[model samples]
Every structure is written in structure tokens, then in C-alpha cells.
Target: MSNSRSTKLHVAIFPCFAFGHITPYLQFSNKLAKRGHRVSFLLSKGAQAKVEHLNLYPNLIHFYPLLVPSVDRLPPGAEATSDVPFPLHGHLCIAIDQTLDQVQTVLSSLKPDFIFFDFSLWMPALAHQTGSKAIYYSVITPVAQALKVPSKQKPEDMTLEDFMQLPPGYPSSSVRIKSKDFETAQLKVVANDLGTGMSIYVRITSSMIWSDAMAFRTYHEVEGPYCDYLRKHYGKPVLLTGPVLPETPATKLLDEKWTNWLCNFKQGAVVYCAFGSQNKLQKDQFQELLLGFKLCRQPFLVALSTPDGCATIEEAFPEGFEESVKGRGWVYGGWVPQTLILEHPSIGCSVTHCGYGSMLMVEELKVAVEVEREDNGWISKESLSKAIISVMGEDSEIAGLVKYNHAKLKEELTSEGMQERYLGTFIQNLQGLLD
Candidate 1:
């Protein structure tokens, strides 16, 4: 199918304040721009610098800065992952509400042909009202494998009864893990029963995102089983856009001494540890992670995100701790050379929050073995283990049921791969089934 080249196909992209959410949207717009589409990336004031750092960014890609209210109470803009204070989280919710108003107006004036939205915005209907092709770009969920036979098994299928009643090890996070769209219909019913007033905006965003025609990030070779499950059950098409990451040219800008040190390691040797943009660690949680890395005893690089006033690692962690991990690890306050670090020959594994961007990176590069946190996706642990077992250990159980099936995915990733993001498989699925 020949896609008529979009000559200045103006596209608007927006994400929440969290870096994990914001980064993927920026990467998506970048891909669109490369295909000759005019792109505008919506970002908070503080978030603009990272996107601006890209050579073709902000200048070639139009930028709309959100004048987010500087509330005194909030923590610095990071994900809700760690020990960020109550004021910080409350501020984020406030900022989100504020951005919604700003975003609505922006869409009204720019009047782009298409608008790509991340899940947190709560305003898909607003974009739709602006006469834009609202693409509900999901950073979560699995690929839909539309094969002739059922190649995957969901958690609900195997058990004696409800899988939640089973032990923690039972497999969950399937393509058929209960259709979020189908469940929302039930939620609409339950909400009506209770006579609660969750806003119409919330309802609309939920409906669009949970719809079966939404796109998935994993390539078919990587998430074949989840894709198969969805293909077998819903028959709704799914687009499979593989790993999306930004280019970091800053490493070469580093001083000679530090640059020389980075050159010494073999490719894929260092482990980069970070919770996703939303997860802020309590002081103890931060230390527990520190201890976990100390146990691993490998070369580590960590990105320690902090609130604006609470940016000090010395205050957050124990003193002289920098000396303890010196030479072995490097920790930055915010932002690191993520794609460059993962693809680095010396870098080996990563400890991450199992976020989409981070998950996509490890999956594409086969870079890390993740330390299990809350299991957000059924495929994450299975995928990470498959990617990292050679450098780490044998396949340990992820959310249970020994994904012995992951062996095939592991082999596929180690060979020729897919980095689909633009007019890739998932977008095709959306145009075919959901449009």
C-alpha cells in the first residue's frame, strides 16, 4: 500500500510532565518529522531543554511551551515514583488539569491534521472536537498477533477459577487480560449505579484508549504471544511500533578525561538503574535499590530523579556513598545518555521501572535484566529476562508461570530486529481496523 507522502502533514504531539511519557511523544514526533511531516511537540517549560538539545528539534519541529503555574507546594517535575512529598504529587495533578486547558486552546488554534496523545492527558475527546485525527498512542499494552492458531495463553484461561485468587507467580498482563475497553463499559455501568460524577472528559479519554483498535509498541517478533491472544479474541487490528528512543549527541561534548573512561568498557557492560518518570522512591526505597546494585557489584550508572528543592543526592542517600560506588557507577540528577548508554558496547544490563520507553530500549537493544518492581505488563519481565539472560542469569520466573515460551522471543531479539515507530505495523493496524 503506497501512502501518499504527507507534504507538511502538520501533527501535534502532547504528553504529561513525567519524562517517560514526554520522551516517547517527542520521539514519535521526531519520526513523523523525518518523514517530511510538520511536527509540533507540546512540552512543559522545564522539559523543553532535553527536546531542544536534538539538532533538528524545536527549530525544525515546532515547540509549544506550556506556561504551567509555578505552585509553591509541588515537588519538582518528576514521575510519581519515589519519596517526593505530598505537595509534589498534588501539584502534578494540578499541573495536569492546567495543561488540559492550555492543550484545548492550542489544538483550537493550530488546527493540525492529526494529534497524537499519551494516556495521562485526559483529553482525547478535546482533540477529536478540534477535527484532528486523534491517535491514542499507547505506550503500554501488548502487540496483537493475528495468526491462524492461538499461540498464546492468558492468565484467565489456565486457572481453576479467578487468576487473582491464585499465587503472585501466576502470569498476568496478557493481550486478553480483560479488554480495558470492554471493562470500561462495565465501569460506566458501575459509575451510573453509584451516581458518582467522574467528568465526561475522563470517560471519553478512557473510551478511546481502551478501544480494540489502539496501537501497541512491541514488534511482532518480540511480543508474538500477546499479539496472538488479542488476534484470537477481539479480532481488532493492532499496530506494532517497535523501540523508540532519542539521539543523545552530548556524550562527545564531554571532557577528554570522562570520555576516555567511557571508551574502556566492552560494549553492553554497564547497568543503568532508574525508576520510570512517575515512580519516586521513598528514602528507604532509594537505599534498597542502592543495596540491590551493590549486591550486583557491576559497573552501574543511575539517574536519581528529585523534586526541585530536593535535588541533592547527598541529602537523599547516605553520606560518602558517592565514594563507595565511585569508578563503578555514575549518577546524574536528571537526564542521562539513555539510548547511547544502552547501545554502548560496555553497557550490560539496566534496572528500570518497566516503563514503555525504557522497556522498548531494552527489548530492541537486548541491553538489560530488570529488577522486578510492581509487574505493570505481563510481557515485561519475560521480555527482559529473554534479553538479558546471557549477561545475567537463567530465566527466573516473571509474575509466575515460567515463560519457557519466551525462548523463541529471546532468539528472535538476538538477531535481525524491528524499530518501527513511523508508518510501521501498529499504525497500519489502526488505519485498517480502527479507522
Candidate 2:
């Protein structure tokens, strides 16, 4: 219905049911719609609210229905989506096996100019059938560009520094960033680093080799030298959209509430803890994390995925921890507005799964990116998506440092530091692209 140059440019956006999954894609959708593109967002019953809150629901043509299996195996509310995070791994084949049957019917009915695939591996056939220009959007940074991953990131226009490299492993390969000189100097420090395993190496290899183009959620100012590194390394058309996130005022108000409570705490005094939407901490393990918070005596917010499938910050917290922390701590029973919390004046640190947006938003939120998303196979599979693969890497040292150096970045996005670079680069790239 849009009567612009891109009126016929219809884009179908699909993100998983998790908060971490939907946030980045919605940011991209808003920008695309502003650019005169017709954007259609498809959601399973689970992610319906998020679509509306982020303001993408009104723009969509239809909602995809998940086939409810006859077996009462799924938890009561979780019927529409398969809670086990396996199918979303970026393999085009597996995704098709699990979702294509339903997705195919909907896509076939609504023809569009382009299909903004969610770094989903299971999209080639659908793309081919629709004859649509497939733009694979990444929620993370670009590794093929060495922009997000932790290894020896080489600069653009910089010559190869005769570094000894690790070969790409099977199933996927690793991006080995060894500094010929830095390696020699820190051989002792580097020796103790536990590197990537065989599977991670393979997954990264596949993503870098595939994916038509990448829309990473990193800013050039924030990443600076690293963003430059990505431009030179990646083969695909790389678009670095700084912290593609929804930083709403309501979200910020909640952040202020928490910040107010932290008045007793010093600047950089609280430890904001959380994991992504999908991964779960068994009640016992979840308790241990809470125990750690108690031991650290730090102000924290831990969002939890619900027993019935919806996301809740409180349900995931220890049974009665919320009542106990009412004055001193916070518990996000559902998807907490993460970006807002990190950007708050009182927030000094974060305990997180080292997710892409989680890492990027920290710049503006003025917090550090800490914690690693549990590196299980499910995460490995999704990492094949450019967004996930590019923002974070599969290297051992990089993973550790994402945690080790987090506290160092506690200052938030500086007015003049790397943060500015990320924003300037993003605005420049998005300049006319949205017009």
C-alpha cells in the first residue's frame, strides 16, 4: 500500500521466538520500511506480542501458524513453536525440514520483491522458488570481515604480516588471527588460551562461505579498527548497522527505576546478569548463578524463560528471590528491555551470554559485554547465520576475553571513542539506503 519507489519492494521478516532473536531483526525492519520498502513480518503465536510492541505487526501481511503436534508432549503454552532450539541453526536444509512446509505456503501466496531472510540457512529453496532477491541479514558482526570475532584482526590496506595460521577445520573452519610478533611476545599468555573445538571451526567456515550479504548489528565508531578489518576480510556486501535495537523510553523508565535502587551502589557498582532467551539454566544451575550474585552482593537482573514457554525474568530467578531483592535487586521475569538497562546511568556492568546485541548495545548503555552464551551445539548451529557468526567468533581466546575484558569497557559509549566511530559509520551507510 506504500506508494513509494519501493512500494513493490516487499520484505518478509521472520525471527525466532526468543528476545535476542527478535530485537535485531525488528531494528532492521524499521529502517527498511522507512526506506520505502513494503515490509511484512511473520510471527508464530509465541512472538506475537513482541511484533506489536516493536511496531512491526501492523505492517505484516500474515502470521505463520506452527503445526501443533498431536502428542501432548510440548508444554501447555509452548505448543506453536518447538522449544528445543535445534531447527533454527542456520542450515537451509534443517530449517526447511522443520519450518518450510508451513512457511512455504504463506510465502507462495504473497509475492514480493525481496525476502529478508533471518540469517536462516534453510532459505535457498524458498528464495529460488519465489525468485526473490534474498538478503541474508545478520544479527551479529561479520567474521569473514574479522570485525566481531576475537582473533588477530588485520586492518584494511594493511599487508599480510606473515602470521602462522591455523587451517580451517572440517564441517566448518576457524578464523585464526595470529600476530607473528604479538604471538611471539605473548606466547606464554596465548599458550594458556583454550581455543575453538572442531565443530565451531567448521560452523564459522560454512557461514563465511555462504550467506549472500550480511547486515551486522555493530557500529563502525564502536568497532573502529575492527570494523575496518571486517570490510577488508568479508567477500559479501557487509552492512554494519550499529546496535540494531529498540531503546524505548518505557524501557528506559524501568532502567531508571533499577538505577534509582542502585543509589546506594557506586558507579560501575552493579553486576547486571542475564542469558539469552533460548538457553536454560536447570533450576539448580540457575540457583548457583543466583548464589553467585548473592555472594558478590552486587545489584543484578536475571531474565528467565518461562516453564510454559513465554520469557520471564522472575520465574527464572530463585523461587522467592524476587520478594527478597525487592529493594536491592531486580528480576526480569520475561524479556527485559536489555538495551535500556545497559544504557542507564547507574548500570556499570553486565553479566550476560555475550550475545551480539548484548555486546553492541553495551557501548551506548555504557556497560561492558560479559558472560558467554553457553557454547552448546544449538548456539553453534545458529552461529552459521552471519549476524551471529560475525558479531562473535568461535575462537577460544576471543571467547575468554569477551568475559575477561568486559569490566574494562564499563564506561559505556564514549562521546569521542570507538562508540562514535560505530554510529558515524552506521549513519553514513544507512544514509540514503533508507531514503
Name the runs in model 2 displaced over 4 angstroms. 1-8, 56-82, 85-96, 144-211, 220-235, 247-269, 305-327, 330-335, 355-435
Model 2, range 1-435, lDDT digits (tens) per residue? 333432335667755444455656766666555444566666555566545666643454444545433222334445223354433222222232356667677778876555555534455447658755455565555433342232334211122232234322211132334344533333322222112211222233234435454556665545554445544455555666555445363433554555566676666555565666666555555655665565445565556555443364455566676676665666555566676667665665455554223323444333333322232312221222222222233453543454445544533433344543554454344333433
CA displacement after TM-score superposition, residue 50 of candidate 1 (Å): 3.5
Q: Model 1, residue 282: displacement in angstroms?
A: 3.1
The RMSD of every model to the true structure, in order and in angstroms, is 8.7, 11.2
Best by TM-score: 1
On a 0 to 1 TM-score scale, where does candidate 1 land against the true structure? 0.64
Q: Candidate 1 lDDT, tens digit per residue, 1-435? A: 234332346778776566666667667667656656678777776667655656355455888878765555555554332324533444455555667778888889988766776544355567668866666566655521121122224321222123112122222332222234433343233223121233223332353444334455556655655565654454545455665545454554544544566676656556666655455556655655665565566666778775334557667755566788888767666656556555565765556664233333334333343443333322233344343344454344531222333444555544443454335544444334323
Q: What is the lDDT of residue 217 in candidate 1?
A: 52
